[model samples]
Target chain A: MVSIQNLHKKFGKHTVLDGLELNIDDHGIIAVLGPNGSGKTTLIKSILGMVVPEKGSIHINGKPLKNNWEYRKEIDYLPQIANFPGNLTVIELLKMIKDLRGEAKREQELINFFGVNKFIDKKLTNLSGGMKQKVNLVLTFMFDSPLVILDEPTTGLDPVSILKLKELLHKEKASGKTILVTSHIMEFVESVSDRIVFLWEGKIYFNGSVEELKEKTNQRDFEHAIATLLTGEHV
Target chain B: MFKILKYSFFDLTRSSWSYIYFLFYLLLGIVLLFLNNDLSNAVITLMNVIIILVPLIGTIFGVMYFYNSREFTELLLAQPVKRTSIFLGQYLGVAVSLSLSLVLGLGIPFIAYGLFQSPAIWDFTMLLITGVFLTLIFSALAFNIALSSENKIKGFGYAILMWLLLAVVYDGVFLLSLVYFQEYPLDKFSLIATMLNPIDLSRILILLKLDISALLGYTGAVFKQFFGTSFGSVISLSVLVLWTILPLLNIARIVKKKDF
Candidate 1:
């Protein structure tokens, strides 16, 4: 339900997204895979209107996203870094977000699912990296928005939590929610994402299912296929 | 905007620095009043302190808050809120909280000393107004500097340089120019120079209102002739307003194109 055309973004002399175009119409897990500095986060932020494109247009659900904010109400974002205000308790931060976005009863359910109820009263600064990531996930999923854009959602998660996250993604996908995610873990991406959009040099290089990517790259292994895509070596 | 402002205000209110700043002014007011034993005299003392100190505190606090709240800012950016509202709300939060500290801090002691019953109430009010204006002006400028500079140390350096330039270096240069051009008619020049610096403009505004121009010598007389009138106060106050507005406008404009 998102369309981007001729998107161009630059930071100083370094061009992040140049004449790039992307479209997302499916309602399932879409893992955006790219190497470091491949404009993955830039692309996501562009859709969220956090980064202003030098020259291009973005549309959400057929409506132009130019100078618009109301469309964000339909989207929930999980930033790569869980850098919350340290002084706020977990519950206060959740309540603050709820207040900003209007009421949402799903927060309690997500909090329970994430098992962050014990850290509810503790300040965010005191939480471990994994706990902070759990809190971030709760904030992102609690809103029950139609679209969710998660940037490296699995950072600092324990194995059990990662499993829990995969299950959570499956549940959301089953509910017909369009989820956009970007991550480096090939195994996690292979297991969770139904559609893979591979990015190279700020442009989409490949878009297909896991089986199709394997057939094209001639590598049965998912991680090796991504490596082949990057290295351009015959498998 | 108000929602963001509310959260920011609440966040800042909980920070210990706000309390330290508030208590500083409160203690300063009480000590100055008890020591000077006169409302007018205490205001004069406060005028000197506020003119120099308010801008410094504003610049430091503004930069610190902007850098510290960066993660929080990014979190808010992904939300449905408008870009300008986030920056403006934070700016107002810093400025208003500081102004509150200055008012209640100084207000407590002065009112305790029966400031309202004295004829110097207007002078006291002018002092606080100038303090608030300086706080707003410098904090907006600091936020602009912080927004432009991504490096925290660099942002802090620029902010402090800004305060030093306006508070100290600007006056030094102003005095040097006055001396170098002694043979020329420099009344208009000096008045314009003073008007350009918010700190100087505030000092002149309060000094003239307190009728302490005699101690200011020749330039004071010239300033007295101009700032002593109602027209001069209106113009000076408007310029102060302009000072606060221009930086805020720059903030809005810069934030629109900024990457983060």
Candidate 2:
């Protein structure tokens, strides 16, 4: 559903994404894993057109994303940071997004699932980080978009909410929606993601199923395999 | 774009700072009218205050809002909205809200003091128009600075420096130059220099409209000779419009290539 080719990005002297290419053709959960400053968020933001790549082309659903914004209508993005206009109430924020994107389906259901109804009337500044993340999740999953991108989705989430989030991801995947997530939690990545795309030093280091990754690294567990990939040591 | 404008306007209008700004003008208008006891005199006093204060407020508020709403801006950027619309809409939102504060805050007291029936009605209107222009011009410049500088403190420092350069330093340098070239014909040169600075242009526009060129020195007379004419008025007004447009166009250009 998304194709990125020859992607090159740099922040000052630090190269983020260099000659990287990624293409996904299926509807499932794909976890983007990387160490710090691995260009994972850069890649995601590039797809969302938030970060303009120095040299690259991105196509979403067979349509070239250059100078085009209408395709974003089919995608829902959950930003890593949940900072919003501190003065706006949760409902006002929701309404504003809904107004911008047109009618949103399942908004109420997602809000109920996240149990953020009580905080709807409160300003965003008053909410705890976990509550804010819940609101972020509600905003992301409410819309009936074909693609959902979550950056650090589990940040500041309670265990119950994390379970809800995993359930929501599964439900969306079951409904044939493509979800792209970036997280450092190996257990969460191993449990939910159908395919793992590991990025190392501005390039895709590994792209395959968990079993394939284990077989390649010859490691007994997923986390060790990731460590092995990073250290380049044979077990 | 309108949707973004609507939200931004609402957001700004609700902020306490907008009310404080409005109340400041309101109190200033009432105090000025009560103290001067004449519509024309009060307008003159207001002309001095507005010329300096409007741009300062606009610059500070523009930078503050842009930096403050950054995450929110990112949220909008990821949406289906066009990039230009988001920035332009926010810019307008700040400019328009500030203009409203200047107008209504000063306006209520002036109207209360029987300003509409006075012959200075046109003068008051000119003052307001100039105030709005300054607000738009400075705010757009501030947004440009904020957009180009990622560091908030640096952006704010640059914006204030810009305001200081145009509002105060420009005049000082102009005076110095006119003194250095006292033997030469500086009328045309002074006029062009004044036109280059929005603050100076606004001061001249209001001063000429108020018909107090005699209070001004030789240069003011030269400005009066130019700005007093119909053709000169049109050119000066167009220059103000151009000042507003150029920064906005820069904003559009910068936002397109900027990495959020």
Candidate 3:
């Protein structure tokens, strides 16, 4: 479970997250949807303690996240970009992360599932965009963290891989893990996420199930409901 | 911190640049010792090179390492690791490896050249000490520059500019100021100025230790008069240590509030 209150963040003159508050205790997938620069990534990074909030406190499982790192042990983060040290081979990178985090509950299994074994010996820089993402995915899911945060997780995946990811995410959710995701693919979000939390201008615009969002916006289709939220249409 | 340091050290050791750096010093030491044919003479020549070159390498290497390891840093930032540990570990990893290259590179030739039996051993040891100190100081400063700069070009630019200012420009300005204010008492001014730049302090320290202050002109005489041989070396070395510690502390402070 993650709790945030009064989160305020700014980049120079622009305010990215302002007086934002969120509480996610649900045990299923929660999609954080927002237009570009709407603080979706900022909100996620805040909870991970990667971005220090100017004002507000975040708690993970009842412990304040300020100046704390141990709480991250229970969290697995897939960064927006899959940039890594190019010199390291894929296997070395995985082993390095595993070594740093002390243990990997299911690394070998995840590696097999993601099919990263094909280019396991190659350097990270040499891998293609989609393959690098596969490596990134393996690194995140290898550790059985209670909280899974995926930022743009579907960046370079093929359709088949994405289907596999959906299956993996559902399995994770079924095991009582809290998964937070952010992606531009509405259909993917709609299919996988149990609850959708829409953000607009640094504030939570809507936090409800898919049916609730559709009924509130008076849109028959899920995509139209989301478009209405963006178009500033009916609530 | 130690684990991060270990990985970084391994990472650098595998890099070809580290080996090239090692070999450059190795070649320099071998050529200098053999050609000079005298321990004391080689020590003095090595002093000149170490004072200037060490800081230059430290700065470039530090900045390059910080920028290059950015992905590694981002990955670590999201994990169960403290911010300070990630940075300090990388900084130390660079400093230690560079120092190793310097010590082993120069030490091999000197030791092979019958250095221990020679009277110039102390001077050689002093040269290595200052070289290591310079490496630690400038790399820490470079890490600070890279940390504060989000753009790699800007970080690299600032790092090189810092080295140029300290290594070459600082002495020129110090002398110009001394000549411009010749009528006034400039002893305190010169001493304070020398202490501010690690390169200058190192130059003065080695010159004083070598008992060659006469060759150094006004500022060296001022340093020699103010702190004598033993005291002057101690004070200069302490300042070098201070230079290293301050930047490292600044890094820790910066990381506390910085966004990844």
- Tens-place lDDT digits, model 1, residues A44-76: 999999999999999999999878888999999
Residue-level lDDT tens digits of model 3 in B4-50? 99999999999999999999989988999898888888888888889
Model 2 Cα lDDT, one tens digit per residue, A86-154? 888999999999999988889899889999998899999999999999999998888889999999999
TM-scores of all predicted structures: 0.98, 0.98, 0.98
Tens digit per residue, CA lDDT, model 3, A1-235: 7889999999999999989999998899999998899999999999999999999999889999987999999999999999998999999998888888978979889889999999999999999999999999999998999999999999999999999999999999999999999999999999999999999999999999999999999998999999999998793
Clashing residue pairs in candidate 2 (N, C-alpha, C atoms within 3 angstroms): none
- TM-score (C-alpha) between model 1 and the true structure: 0.98
Write down the TM-score for model 2.
0.98
User: Which lDDT tens digits does candidate 2 get at residues B153-194?
Assistant: 999999999999998999899999999999999998988887
**DockQ, each predicted model:** 0.85, 0.84, 0.86
Error of 1 at A235 (Å): 11
| Interface RMSD of each candidate, angstroms, one decimal | 0.7, 0.7, 0.7
Worst 10 residues of 1 chain B by lDDT: B212-221
Candidate 1 per-residue lDDT over residues B191-239, each given as its tens digit: 8888889998888777767777555545556777866656667777899
